[model samples]
Target: MHAPPSPLEAERSDGGSGSVRIGVLVPLTRPGWVEAGHHLLAGIELAGREVNDTGGIAGRPLELVVRDTAADPRKAAAAVDELARLGVAALAGEYHSVVARAAAARADALGLPFLCSSAVLDALTEQPTEWVARLSPPQSRGWRVYADFLLGAGHSRIAVAAQPSIYWASGTRVVRDHLAPRGGTVIELDMNALTPAAVCDALVDHRATALLLLVGHPEPAVSIVKAVRRDQRLAEVMMGAPAGQPEFAAWATSLGDDGAGIPFLRYLPERLGPLGARVERALRERLAGAPSFVAFEGYDTITVLADVLRSHGTDRARTAESWPRVAVQGSRGRIEFSRTPGISVWQWTGTPVHVVDRDPAEPGRFRILHAG
Candidate 1:
């Protein structure tokens, strides 16, 4: 019941004395997510630098009071309190849905504006609050997109490999809910209960044409992929995952050849327009690696936050009040929100979903298979 620990350092340019500070929440040293946190932090920092270089918001520079949630929900909620206490104009940046849920609750209670960068649990947006907004589409909508894509690809008998996390659970539930009634058969496999060999057995037994993975962590998914790739019978069977999109590099690096030809849902396009291309290049140069979907999420989240702070000044209430109407152009598309049912309060609607498949011809390269 102690408050979440504050960031050791505030990231900003020189002359931050008059800068506008915003709370940036990310899992910096969380178990199994250190690399992801670095990617997110890089994106947010890139956005902050861009805004400052362009004269900042209302002629004042932007600074981030970053807080590490360590992938803990309680800590995330406490971080919200600490951020609000620090007098930030708004809150932004998140990678874990569980943390996002807790942070959303705290933001609602404090009447502060919070923009989720990349957490996609459907219920995060379903909460009754006016201050919470998300840059990513909720899983309720995104999963359906996955389901439709699978069914349209002529995949009828599908097997789902799932972990026990709520994020994975939500994904399995949506695929089952959407695909079952469409004459598609779904078989669920618990990642903990089933060995890679046992999962392969089930796929062969069920004659499943495709496997839908709900496990978020890369190691489990990697094990399953490695096992299936060695089986000749399962070689032709398609494998897809909603959770794979964000941590694809980790999975690919581990699974190697097994990772190729696997399909996953991504939030942004592989290709970009002029503005997006510039941002993507900047992020790649800054991170010294390929840009992730969450990087775009981080960049877009802060860009929208800068716009809100610029127009509404540093008043949290006015920023929350103005959230519903503010339409800022993001790296992907126009970032806007409305009070839509079955979504979080002030959640952005019509967030695009794209299916990218790891190329078999060229390892580690993802080719856009479908766009929606």
Candidate 2:
């Protein structure tokens, strides 16, 4: 069996001699994301333990300096400064776009390498800095992928509901732009300004075949689905959301049968590899529940960091320079980074995203519609 994680003390600070410290930034107590933070931390700790057990980076054990972002931008920025003060070699693990943007700025100012674990905001990468990189695809590309799925599914008239945040707004624009040329009608709806009933009215007026949600939370997404299901005219309309992927349970429980046909993006595979299967089993047995995609992201972040440190040692400059060149076969898929214009620098362009939906026959299970 693999070894358990190091003591809590090790997570707070460096514990042993010859240990390379990597700062972990996660939201543990955010208003709606406490559970998400825990899952991400679980995956990070698991990978760190495995790295340490397998002779660490050049025989130096990997130490994670865990810090809670709390879904606050200022807190995330402060945490980066704090972790740097604690002598961490690199910064990793942030799920929120706002927090990731703040952490990335702080890490850049501190001259520390920061690898964003799951934040997808394009602005996070748009900043000109070699110190920042992301494991998730830009929201624009992710939205485009979803748009392609809609077109492939014969959804010509799609209603777009998006969060006010640029993270969602930019992606919404991509979807509209992609569909306009294909003779597909995209009616934009303000998620904050319009009630679910109003959105439903708009969808019906437009004769929309699908509703695309680009949001950061599950509330409005669920509310809209519940609203859509309540109307017979909208019953035939497909409701798809990218935000629901992270909070599948919340969506499923809140909407029940209403969530069956809806599709959302997620990174985890229905079936795991041998290593991933073992990790999942161990996490499930320990946590008394199944793991989520955040867990997989956390695991892979550490794995990539370990690989980078292994090849480049602890020199911050060399490590940052080598980030674009670093590649590892992570749990999700081939983990690699490349600089793309309009995307972020050193961003992981190969994130495995699949459109998943709840199976009507088996409510607990999911059905993958398309892999991108």
Candidate 3:
């Protein structure tokens, strides 16, 4: 088979006239989560189409210049630079947190307004800057809620099967820190040095009631689930994935019944409002499946950016300046930005956080276990 297209070779434009351009960064190839990227792009494209249908940002059609980051921080940073030079009015979209952080830093240095779609790392930038804002709830907020769920479920001794990365490391710290103060204990199972079977052994040795899959999808995550599920000792052990590995259909297709009942964090309201419902139906048709929260985030990124471009014009500085003034109805809820403590960028504090899992009897359907 031919090698996947390079980031530059894969770049393309989607929707609207070329008069006004928005840079779209997504992980559309391997090493990146291609499935998540597709869902994200669908939402962005749908919103862009709708914006054009409604009059196209003050009659100047909003164009999207897309680039594939391939889950690489360096690639994403370079894409930000190239998009900035291309005269894009702003930058948007990135699923991986580390990649988003790199892109955010570059955008800030260059003064390009970036509305990050789905990377939830608490620190998207090393220092505060007005040029970057985020649509997803920070990792600390979501993962802390997840830790609370673990406590409520009576799991005090928890184990995390984690891969080495800044994102995974931060998540581990969040779970550990949040749990330690509340009579909960966390055990770490390093995936770098352990096999699936070894992970099962570690879980049993630690007497961990819950095993959180903090690794990548379909490789160690899938293998660990299988190994643990088959091990009689782990039968009573609960499995969780707060980073949302099982949110996509592939997780079901790969693990099926084995994948069900593993709780994960998602940033969606318990119920969709009128705008959310309308967008859901459209996104469903576009994706040919239920859209993940990431997709809604992508759609909302465009929705907010479109609003800013319309009111603030296409000037980069003007777009960055309008973050605090934003109050648009997104697919999830009323989108607004503010300076949240410990977070470096303009944050939408209202993005809903939910703990959900696939039903054991019906792997295709999700059951909301807890909300935060």
Candidate 4:
């Protein structure tokens, strides 16, 4: 178990730490975002409940302030500003990477210590201010992890299909980096330039050993699977990270046994530490009728935030200092942040990797291809 910091050590102030106040900003209507957000909130609630159950942080109950960004960047900035004016000790979240930029800016202006839970895009934290720290692994890290997994799997050729979004552009270079040293080749495709049918056509021509998909939205991910089906090449391809959204659930029907066969490289699972149990229990209990990567991620993100509150005596200064130590055992294993630029932990450490086999008729609906 990781040890908590001592009082003197915990006194470091990134922002004036007083009563622990957290302002949460998320897009409440981004289809899968809300359900995922609920889990995150649940995690926060659970942590708060524990602290209050134990007698509040520093003898004061934590005040959780929330606002909906509606997945809009302008609204996100405004929401953070509103939260800052309300004088939150620290700020946590804005789900979309684009929205996070605005919220993060507001936090910086206030000199408030802010930690972003998701927003894995590289540019999200590129130019750090005194107020920001990202809890999610950077986009660059995600790609490198992909490279490692594929290269280690003995695949020498890979093809890339990325969602047409700014987030994916930031780490596009990592694909080459991962392939560089190993003599593997990477082929790239743009979602905007090609329809699912077009994408499927391109994949057929590549004939690469594996597929490196950086799709963020579920609709496209599902479409890609369907598009590929025309050629009946489900087994010929694989997937990496950014495949955890609730939208992927629809693909299970079309791919059937093949859908369950998709490989995943992502964060959260039992290895991240306390998060695995946290997510499994939350997903199984509250979201019993559902399955999603975002559900687990959202839950773990809020759970970590709540724990941060309890760590620093519920005081703002302590809360700010506690950001660095706040760790969540996500579905993938323990997730933490680095103060360094272009560096974040993405390895599963001691977690399990689950690949969804699209083939429903298969007994191995999911398998642990790698166990940390």
Which candidate leads in lDDT?
3
Q: Which residue pairs in candidate 1 collide?
A: 125-343, 125-344
List where candidate 1 sits over 4 angstroms from the true fold: 1-17, 245-247
lDDT per model vs. reference: 0.80, 0.79, 0.91, 0.58
Ranking by TM-score: 3, 1, 2, 4
lDDT of 3 at 30: 88
Taking the tens digit of each residue's C-alpha lDDT, what string does model 3 give over 1-372? Answer: 122432322332443334578899999988999899988988988898888779887887777788899999998888889889888899999999999999999999999999999999999999999999999999999999999999999999999988999999999999999999999999988888999999989988899999999999989888899999999988899999999989999999999899999999998899899999999999999889999998999999999999999999998999989999999999998999999999999999998999999999999999999899
lDDT of 4: 0.58
True lDDT of residue 145, candidate 2: 75
lDDT of candidate 2 at residue 266, scale 0 to 100: 77
TM-score for each predicted model, relative to the true structure: 0.93, 0.90, 0.96, 0.76
Q: Which candidate is the best by TM-score?
A: 3
Measured over all alpha carbons after superposition, the RMSD of each candidate to the real structure, in angstroms, is: 2.7, 3.7, 3.0, 7.5
Which scores greater on lDDT, model 3 or model 4? Answer: 3
Report, for all candidates in order, the number of backbone clashes.
Answer: 2, 0, 0, 33
